[model samples]
Target chain A: MRNELNRVVMRFPSKSINEGLARSGAAAFASQLDPTLDELGDIRTAVSEAVTNAIVHGYKDEIGEVIMTMKLFEGDEIEIVISDKGCGIPDIDQARQPLYTTGGAERSGMGFTIMESFMDSLKIKSAEGKGTTVTMRKRLNTRRYR
Target chain B: MKLIHDMKGGLLTVRLEGELDHHCAMDITARICELIDALLPPRVRLDCSKMPFTDSSGIAVVMRSARAAQGIDSRFTVAGLCAQPMKVLRAAGVDRLVEIEEEVHI
Candidate 1:
């Protein structure tokens, strides 16, 4: 939030189907920077993971709202934060581990890994019984975007 | 998202278009499992070239398909993955497990 040049905030219900909505909304807002196809794809994937985490783990079976905030900073850096007021992660370190999935079966537990790989920085904050927030930042190598 | 299944020479290829996310993965997973169980093709191929975007849920789709194929003891291959699908598949080290018909360099 510090030294932010531009920003967008949106909130939606914690439904499984809203995963696509959140991803596309973030990608559409990022498109103003004219990011490359690969860059856009990375942004899309990262948002999808964050929103999915909110819906799948944060809310579990209950219904809630997911708040998404996007900020554009100098040097063409784009930052995104997905937050939820649902059950928070009890073990942040363990949950962030690659292949560590609380959602059994096909989850693959690669959500954070994919977000970390695609974005420049990924920060997770949570308090048990409170909520969890995930913030990701990436500097769009802006030469082409400019 | 839309899914199409085609059978040729005993090989069943599933072509996916549009975005694949948690929204549609459930039905896609069920359809994939059903197809594989019923047809029991010698080989199954997933076409991702036309896909615009895919996420971790898409990974679940692929895994479910692989499991379904395994249930029938059939070979499975992923073909024409580009952009998003390609990046995700590589990072999950899925290439180490499933066969990619086209070379996808991470």
Candidate 2:
């Protein structure tokens, strides 16, 4: 792990409405790194996907606590970890596949795919009936002179 | 998010305003599907010009809307998407399912 410059930990309810709050909050915090507009959008979208997964898939039919930790490292790197203490995923491999959703018809099952594509790296850890944690990292290459 | 719909000459255009995410996806899908079923237009256009932000949930909304239109043999199109939403749609291969017209800048 690189030397951490800053960090923030947020704990919120697994309410559907908090999805927006989580993403926007992450984006706002990341703005300090002077990310480009496109980079900010990617970070926001990735955070949204991970948070949505915690709310919808992790705690299906119930409300649980969701924890999000944002860390800023040297060299404009941002690492985000979203975890839920809801029902853990049975198969992380199948769950990561594109268009493979246990979330039924309304879910596109593209959450992990989006997070993987938008971020630099994605890591998932889960144990069935225990919980799930998603960690994503991205390094923003802004041309701004420091 | 705000959804505005209008039907003209068998074509229905629904413009989405504000961020589209899991919070509002169910309502948006419901409203769009209801309009499609009620009007049964020959062509449906989802105007995403004002919708600047979205995640995978937006993809589900588009997919469900397209399915609704397809059920009635209606052509569905998504137009004027911003960069982020467009990337998501393409990432999910939704562009293959529906016609897409990116925002044009002069």
TM-score of each: 0.94, 0.96
Q: Which residue window of length 10 is worst by lDDT in model 1 chain A?
A: A137-146
lDDT (10s digit) by residue, model 1, range A1-56? 45778899989999977887888799898988889889999998999999999998
lDDT of 1: 0.87
Model 2 lDDT per residue over B14-69, tens place:
99999999889999999999999999999999999999999999999999999999
Candidate 1 docking category? medium
Tell me the tens digit of each residue's lDDT in model 2 across A1-146: 78999999999999989988998789888999888889999999999999989888999989999999999998889999999988999999999999899886668999999999999999999998989999999999966753
How close is candidate 2 at the interface, in terms of C-alpha RMSD after superposing the true interface residues?
0.8
How well does candidate 1 reproduce the true complex, by DockQ? 0.70
TM-score of chain B of 2: 0.95
lDDT per residue for candidate 1 within B1-106, as digits (tens), equals 8899888888998888888887788888888888888898998898887787888877888887997898888999888887679789889988888888773222
